[model samples]
Target: MRKVVKYLIVLVVFFMIPICILAHPGRLDANGCHTCRTNCAQYGLQDGQYHCHNGNSSSSSNSSSSNNSYNNVTTRKTTTTRKTTTTTKKQVYGCMDSSAINYNVDATNKDGSCQYEKTETKTEDINYDTKIKGNLKEGNKTVIEEGQKGQKEVTIKSVVDEDGNEISSEVVSEKIIKDPVDEVVEYEEEMSDSEALTILIIYVLNIILVMFYSKKNKNSKLIINYVRRIKIRIIKYIIYIIYFVYVIPVFIDVILVIIDFVKRKLKK
Candidate 1:
């Protein structure tokens, strides 16, 4: 019985040794190849390293996705901030009237830009004509009054450039110094023919009457010589007195009337 048990034990040991060798077929080296141990090769390798690549790659992809999402969010925020920070400049335009000499018709706004030309003034003397007042006969003139020239003050306005050239000028105001006086004159007129004839007839009649009276007195027969002589003297004296009193005044009046008429005609 002991011999038989020994043989059976040896056969059992030999069968167990073949089964172990069949289970592990590869040798142990740097490739990390294993006969009985399962390694990273079952999960796949990364950059030639023995590691659980599936888990690392999956975790890395998730992390990268998270990082990309975070980066996208940050980039979008930065772009929006930049857009909000930027600004545009404003533009303005207008016209300035204070410095300009002439009025501008087209400018819509005032910018305080304007230009002006130079200006000047001048003065001069003036003479005025005389005015006539009274009358004189045709073809006759006399200065009843004298005339004198008057003076005037004048102001001139002018625009000049920087070159000392005149642009334009105008009168600003005028004044008087002394007014002139007008002259007056007059002349006489001749008496009419009818008026002369009437005076002559009256003079001749008076002469005839005086002569007749004297002769009558000289030839008187009834009166005494002394009485006749006295009467004759008295008569002659009365005749002379009447002629002087009436005729002299009438002649003076006629002369005055003629002068007045001539003056009035000249006035007209």
Candidate 2:
């Protein structure tokens, strides 16, 4: 039983080595293919020259003394030979990136050969100011001209090196696509006729109230009260005269102009 187990183990080991060699034939040598464990040149062809041999030996002999017969035969040997040659390759250099425009298909190393489109842009700003040309109230604004943005286009020219790096850039041509329109805001600082009239009325009423208070608060000092009353009356009278002469005339003129404009509009 021991001998039979040993024999079975030997058979299994013997068969397993050949099976492993057949399964991984290229794992033997890193630089080139290797022969199998059977020494029969494995199964497939190798890179360099390879040879395999299989031979069979057989012999037959017969002798008969009674008849004194003699026989002879000659055999010729046959052999087959196979040869292979491998050529050494050179290293190729070119763009290795697949997304580049100048990608080379037969490139073995990256040479950084690539190209791309270039562009540039420039811009400027426009400002505006407010102005008042006619009679109008203060702190008022109106848009006389609308505002718009402008842009300038430039054709950028650049030179790239053999390594796909930008060496220099220049503006070849430039032109304005749209001219900026400056904003114009019309402002009004002067009051109209109706506003001046209302202010004048308010001032008159305020002065009358002051006079009534002064008269009611006339104290034991009668002379001082009289002088104060005179000063107040004189100041108010002068202010009223100034308004009537300068401010009131302007108001009247504005009213006349507005009435004329309304009549013309009605006629139309």
Question: Largest lDDT belongs to which candidate?
Answer: 2
TM-score, candidate 1, is 0.26
In order of appearance, the predictions have TM-scores of 0.26, 0.27
Q: Residues 148-249, candidate 1: write the lDDT tens digits.
A: 566666677666543456767787778776565554545444445466556656665665665567568744333344344675787766655654465565
The positional error of residue 215 in candidate 1, measured at the CA in angstroms, is 34
Could you tally the backbone clashes for each prediction? 6, 1
- Model 1 C-alpha lDDT versus the unseen true structure: 0.48
Candidates' C-alpha lDDT = 0.48, 0.54
List ranges where model 1 is wrong by over 4 Å.
1-99, 103-133, 143-146, 157-172, 185-268
